[model samples]
Target: MRITLERSNLLKSLNHVHRVVERRNTIPILSNVLLRAEGASLAMKATDLDLEITEATPAMVEQAGATTVPAHLLYEIVRKLPDGAEVLLATTPDGATMTVASGRSKFSLQCLSEADFPDLTAGNFTHSFKLKASALKMLIDRTQFAISTEETRYYLNGIFLHTIESAGALKLRAVATDGHRLARADVEAPSGSEGMPGIIIPRKTVGELQKLVDNPELIVTVEVSDAKIRLTIGEIVMTSKLIDGTFPDYQRVIPQANDKEMRVDCQSFAQAVDRVSTISSERGRAVKLALNEGHLTLTVNNPDSGSATEEVAVGYDNDPMEIGFNAKYLLDITAQLSGDDAIFLLADAGSPTLVRDTAGDDALYVLMPMRV
Candidate 1:
């Protein structure tokens, strides 16, 4: 079997699918990518049992056939080929080796029977919907940083996606938490999303989906079942297994009675925190926020090293109070704010604090305090 395709087209498709192949695999077939050439198109697929990605690119198919080869090895070979060059993939009579010829370079890679490759069979989808790429990107970017990495609480390792009626309108919401901080973002629910069961998209899938949604004009089709989800973007199709666990109710941790309010320039506050935290040790880098009427003092004390203090004027007029927070957590939440001013609603030095963006009400964050 033989097929010829443009190097650019082959490279793009491989770039999208090869990422799903794990670097190290216990199974031999799992390390290879399945390639099928048929009807003027070449389809490529790679999987790690839990997640699978498939993409098809246009090709001149002289003979239709299928085989498997090392995913990363082939990708590297195609990537090094000259731009705009054509690539020819041909298999021998015994299908023992595949030849990749492009320009003056040729490579012979050991081949495996396509039948040996596994397929992640998606039985049926209970809900399917379409969403704008920009909207999807917003929800992911706002909350991805808060996803928990603790293996024990597997439920918190992914973003919880569901629909809810808020302000008399149905909205699609994404929430993630690590017990210390929580991020929640919302977008207007698209049609066909109503009554969809909430699903926890695994962390790996969210990362890959984020990379594909860079084009704001693209429309992404989403199909979800109880245990698996499939996303179609342009010619690329991605299927991933959903994390099977119950996500803790994150709303209870969000403070509702945080009366003390503080408003400060986002950039200035972030820079001050960064400068002060430089003096903090690597472990338990806590920054103390001492708030007074219209003034805030940021301090970091490291007994082994030194101390740091900076003052910034704020819009606070409440009773003065001191609160402690992780320097890294403060910076993470601030980076997600797309506004000039960051609003912090505080209850006390121990309870959780709520953060909001002045630019929009679509996203919010709650951060737990650290002992300083």
Candidate 2:
């Protein structure tokens, strides 16, 4: 294919597609990015069997052709070229090699048959909706930290996305957990989003999609089916197979009877937990929380090492209660709070606790207590 494009534009498109290409591939074509030059546009596609990304950029196509080249190598070559340089890509008659040139630099990259590239079949999606990029990113960022890395319970390895009717309004909800803690976030359901099927989007796909949502002005179109899910943003599209396992009933784990509430400054509480965790290096990062009337004390003790205790004034008027929790878990939950104040609801030392932002009730987090 003979195509001319600005160096920066090509590099930007490559960066988006390259995320799906694996570093080491058992199949030769899997290491290459498929380039197709057609009517004033160039399409770059890459996949790793599980996820696929396709990006199109405006280019001057002199000859209509297609070929595959090393994804990383091509990306590096274009990246190192001088800014504002024009890139020329052409393929020989036999299509055995691809020639790339920019100013004084030129190189020939080995090519693979475009026919060998895996094709992702479009699934029959009955439901589709549009979401603001910022809203979707917030849903993923707030709950992704709780996704399980353990492969044994495969259902817990992704974010569970579904629709729920709460307070007489439909809401889009995302939930994730790894047994120790659970995170849940909700937003107003978009137009035409009714009756959408619940799907478990795998962790890796969620991470890759998150990078593409940086542009707040862009709106993403999402299509979901029983077997596959597709997300389209601007000129880029991503398709992936959905996890087959059923996610556990997360609602059961959320505490409904926790009445003892404590409100603390989010940043201060996180910093205190981080400081105390340093003392207990061998005890799995445990920190004790002792709460009293209008005062909260954080303490960490390691028999072999020293102990640390810090007290912060809070907005709690409940009876004195002492609870032990892993400092890391506490920080993870607090990091998701969107406001300066974090509200914690505790039933007792032995019951699970619920946390929420003081500014709104759109998001809620629950953490199971740990013995110190």
Candidate 3:
């Protein structure tokens, strides 16, 4: 196989596919990327059994053929090459070695047989829909931070996506939680996604997919089946197997009758949490929030370290309440709010507190309070 491709294009495609290739693999072929040249296009694929990424780039195909080469080594070689340099790749009939060339530099990399590479079979996808890139980005950014990392609760390690009817309108909702904090966001569902089954997208897949949705105008095509999901953005495609466990019912955990509501500037609240958390030790990053008529004060006291307190003006007319929460959790939830003010709904110091963006009710967060 022989082909010539632009260095920049090759590098960009490699950057996406190479990340899927594991540094240490039990199978030799898993460490290599499958490169196939056909007509005027070249396809690069890499996989780790659970997830696969494929990208296509325009190339001048001298001879249509396929071979496997070390993904990271090839990526590094092309990355160090001069700008706009043309990359020439050719494989021998035995498929034992791949020769790479650019200007005065040439390198030979050990290759594996293409037949040894694992092939991902995309099962029949029943539900397919399109979503705006910006909308998808919002869903991921808001909820991914709350995804659980505990391996035992495998189901909570991903974002839960499903279609729901709210206020006589169909909405697509994404929810994630780690038992301590939860993030939920919604967007108008596309017309055809009315009866789609809820799916838990794993954390690794979410991280990789988020990298492809930078363009606000680009529309992403998503295809989902019982076991796998495929996301298509531009010329790139990502396919992954969904977790086979049941996610806990999250609705029951959300507080329903929290009467105390306080509205504070998002920036000011975040700053106060940041300053108060500085005095908290590593074991317990707790901060106490004291609320009165129109004033909110944040306090943190650690036996090992010192203490800190900060005050911020807010709009609250409810009875004076005091609550304790993890400072990091508060900062993370506040960071997701796009507006100037954040609404905090509380039942009591022992009960979970709900947070929302003052701009709208489309997104909501629930954070479990800590005992000070």
Candidate 4:
């Protein structure tokens, strides 16, 4: 196979697939990227059994053939090449080595038979839909921070993606929790997803999906089946196996009767949490929030370290209430609120507290209080 591709285009496609290739693999073929040059473009594929990514880019193809090369090594060579340099990839007649040449630099890499690469066969998809990139990004950003990392509760290890009817309109929702905290966010349901089954998108897939939705203007095509999901953006396609587990009913976890309310500047509250948490011990890192009529106090006390306390003005008209929480959890939920004011709905000192952004009603967070 022989092909000439622009350095930028090749690098972009390589960047997408190399990330899907695991650094250490038991099978040698799994560490290499399968490249196919045909028609007017070249297609590259990388997979780790659980997830696969394929990208195609326009190239000047002198001959049509297929081969496998080291994914990361090729990416590194292309990345270090001179700007706007055209990269040439050609395989030897015996197909034992692939030669890469650009400008005055050249390198040869051992080749693997493309037939040795594992096939990522996608099952039949029952649902197909299109979501605006911005909406998809919002759905992921708001809930992924709360996803559980505990392998024992594998159901909570990924974002729970499903559809629900709310106020006479169908909405797509993403929910995640780790027993201590929960995050829920919603967006208008895309057409054709009304019959979609709820699925648990694994954490690795979510991270890769985030990279594809960075551009707000792009519309992502989503295809979902009971066992797999495929997301296509332009010339790149990412496919992953869905986690086989049932997500707990998240609505029951959200507090509904919390009456006490406090509204504070989002940035100020985050800063106070960051400052006071410095004195918190590493084990718990707990911070106590005391709320009164018009003031909120954040305090951290550790047996080994010194104490820290900070006061911020807020719009709280409720009676005095004190609750403890993990400082890092509070900061993560607060960071999701881009609005000026963050609203907190409190039930009491023991129950969960609800948090929302005054600027948007589509997202909410529930944080379980800890003992001070």
| Candidate topping lDDT | 1
As for lDDT, the candidate ahead, 2 or 4, is 4
Tens digit of per-residue lDDT, candidate 1, span 338-363: 99999999999889999999999999
Model 4: per-residue Cα lDDT at residue 247: 96
Quote the positional error of residue 73 for candidate 1 in Å: 0.7
lDDT of 2 by residue, 1-372 (tens): 799999999999999999889999989899999999999999999998889999999999999999999999999899899999999999989999999998999999999999888988876888899999999998999999999999999999999999999989999999999999999999999987799888999998999988999998899999989888899999999999888999999999898999899999999999988888889876478889999999999999888888999999999998999999988889898988879999999998888999999878988999989887
Better of 1 and 2 by TM-score: 1
Q: Residue 212's C-alpha lDDT in candidate 1?
A: 88
- Find the 10 residues in a row with the least total lDDT in model 1: 245-254
What's the C-alpha lDDT at position 143 in model 1? Answer: 100
Give every collision pair in model 2. Answer: none
Pairs that collide in candidate 1 are none
How do the residues 1-372 of candidate 4 rate in per-residue lDDT, one tens digit apiece? Answer: 999999999999999889988899889999999999999999999999999999999999999999999999999999999999999999999889999999999999999999899988998999999999999999999999999999999989999999999889999999999999999999999999997999999998898888888899999999999999999988899999999999998889898899999999999899999999998888988999999899999999998878999999999998898999999999999999979999999999999999999878899999999999
Candidate 2, 271: how far from true, in Å? Answer: 1.1
lDDT by residue (tens digit), candidate 3, 1-372? 999999999999999999999899988899999999998999999999999999999999999999999899999999999999999999877778989999999999999888888988998998999999999999999899999999999999999999998889999999999999999999999866779889999999999988888899999999988789999999999999898888789999999999999999999889889988988999899999999999998999999878999999999999998999999999999999998999999999999999999788889999999988
Overall local distance difference test of candidate 2: 0.92
Q: How much is the lDDT of residue 156 in candidate 3?
A: 95
